[model samples]
Target: MKNFKPIWLMVCTLALACAPSSKDEQTAENEETSIFRHQPLVTHMYTADPSAHVFEGKIYIYPSHDIETGATSDDMGGHFDMKDYHVFSMDEPGAAVKDHGPVLKLEDIPWASRQLWAPDAAHKEGKYYLYFPAKDQDDIFRIGVAVADNPAGPFKAQPNPIKGSYSMDPAVFQDDDGSNYLYFGGIWGGQLQWFEDGELVAGRKGPTDGIPAPDQAALMPKVAKLTADMLEMAEKPKDALIVDEQGNPILSGDNQRRFFEGAWVHKYNEQYYLSYSTGDTHNIAYAIGDNPYGPFVHKGNVLLPVQGWTNHHSIVEFEGKWYLFYHDTELSGETHLRNIKMAELQYNPDGTIQTINPMK
Candidate 1:
């Protein structure tokens, strides 16, 4: 509605100036050409659900690879492509693509019998860890974790499942205060975890694990502070809730009408912005909060329904501008065809998000 048609033309010129434009100098003698050229920074063909991280001096994107012997379409269930995992890197955040390795795959996991999707990575001590939601041939999806000394990994999965439940889209976080927490799940509920000892055990499926207890993933988003050991819950490790039942020190997001799933945390100055994909990923949404783990106040439409479907995003601020890293179905189709995209996020001076258009 902003008449961004010119934006597309500019993007084409910016994206294709190196190509043979077939323009004649004689016919355009008086014309000034603003031909901007941009190469494709991402090229993990047949992939999506990209989880991006900036490690050391390079930027890495880990996307779920959906390639079958010969499938022609994609749907909500990702019927067209089973899952294979791959990682790609770039010199700068939005420029210079690099290849670290195909670093990981489902076959790398001994206990995993099928699809591997939505991989999240983090750096700890002197090592790196990758957590993902994967499904076996039986179609039952479970959460798994692997490690490597390098950001790019020959990531090897341990012998068991982290959380053997039907879930997808996980994000691992080591908050600003040096707190380590993990968030995952799509429509079901985004659950939280605290890294204490050596094992990443199931904690209170707080607010986001929408359903009451016994449900594998909680119905809403939760914040569980990891115990000193950095693996399980604190002293009384049994109750996953970091606080009390009336939503004490921290509040959370829940219900189908708001904060559906796929959450991320970005700390800007004194406040932290918690962005999540809402309305079933087909149409995404965002919410903001003063605290990292909060009853985030809705910032209003960060993204509306994108081309059919989209979800599992990463957002970070570099320099002084905000850039959103998300995947949509425009390039491939459906959930996993998550072409890693970079877009400018408009924000009000008061720290709230402005309206934005769908990604191309």
Candidate 2:
């Protein structure tokens, strides 16, 4: 669900969190706010290309489900078996329905084989890994791995997948130093990996034109700087735009194309909020960073970009509030019949991140 189309224009110069100096006024450190305003209370009528996790307190939605006319559930690993992949839980926001389905597919998998796209799942240490983007047997699409203990499972797959070439969206993060990171590519630019028990020590590759792209779209991004067992990289190979989150400077040349790519990081209070998905994912843009590898900063406009392509998004807090996991496409207006959604996210008391506009 890399909707891609978003690209509007943002500029927020920082301040109580910027951009709301007048949208109605609130940030004088909290004009006595009450809660839940700008967006996302629920909208996922079918859920598409989404990813979320908050366990225990609730909030679970894995997207890119298939079959039932929409095709692709030959067991969740397509090539035409039909398609299959599911995992749903909705403590709220778009409260998914329809039995929450599959849990995992591709006929339950056997390995080194077939086609699967998108399919992202994460939950470290205790179990669960389902990161999609498959196609071995020589077809080459890259990225695949599976294992489960719960989170609606039945998963298995392995025998292959978890390298690179033409990977699709596969996100699995677990950082803060504890390690474990894997992000994929799409629309045109995306890639990143780091695993251990699941293998694949390290990775990164992207740009047939996508990811903070724009050079007419050949959006090249190539990063490599690992050794601490991230498997590979670092004999000298760097180019994920040099580093923009705090190492500073990065934007590069033609303004570095545009279509920013999807990256998420959240912490607040002491800083570490880096959210992504920009213009070209059907219109959605965000930037912030005390570090997620970004000179981030772009916080001024297009916070959700509705009216057309929406996108793959994530951010969480639930029950305690704070959310942004996304996916849109009019929920029906076509656009691949998109779904998966969430909203409620309004911060400012000096934490930054607050801007919405797509309700037209």
Candidate whose lDDT is highest: 1
Each prediction's TM-score against the native? Answer: 0.69, 0.29
Give the per-residue lDDT digits (tens) of candidate 1, residues 1-360.
Answer: 111223545555555555555557422421343221112245546556666777876667776765544544332354534445667877666567666657776667877765576677877786777777766554445567777888888787666665323355667667777777666555432222322232323653333233434323233543444444333323221222222234442223332224455667777666666666664534455555556556555555566555544565677555566766666554343443445566677677787777666532
Q: Can you tell me which runs of candidate 1 are displaced by over 4 Å?
A: 1-40, 69-81, 136-139, 163-166, 188-218, 226-257, 333-338
Query: What does the lDDT read for residue 116 in candidate 2?
Result: 51
Error of 1 at 209 (Å): 14
Q: How many residue pairs clash in each candidate?
A: 23, 44
Q: Residue 137: error of model 1 in Å?
A: 7.4
Candidate 2 deviant stretches above 4 angstroms = 1-60, 63-88, 91-129, 132-142, 147-151, 162-168, 171-216, 220-257, 263-276, 279-341, 344-355, 358-360
lDDT of each: 0.55, 0.50
Tens digit per residue, CA lDDT, model 2, 1-360: 333222221112133356456544635333332122333223433455567777655677677652224434231223122256777776675554434566666655545354455566766556766777655564445656677777677677666554443445655555567555554443332322222222333332323222332223223223223224333322333223323334443332323223345544556665655455553534444545554344455454336465444366777777777877666554344444555556667887866667765453
Q: Give the best candidate by TM-score.
A: 1
The ten-residue window of minimal lDDT in model 2 covers: 4-13
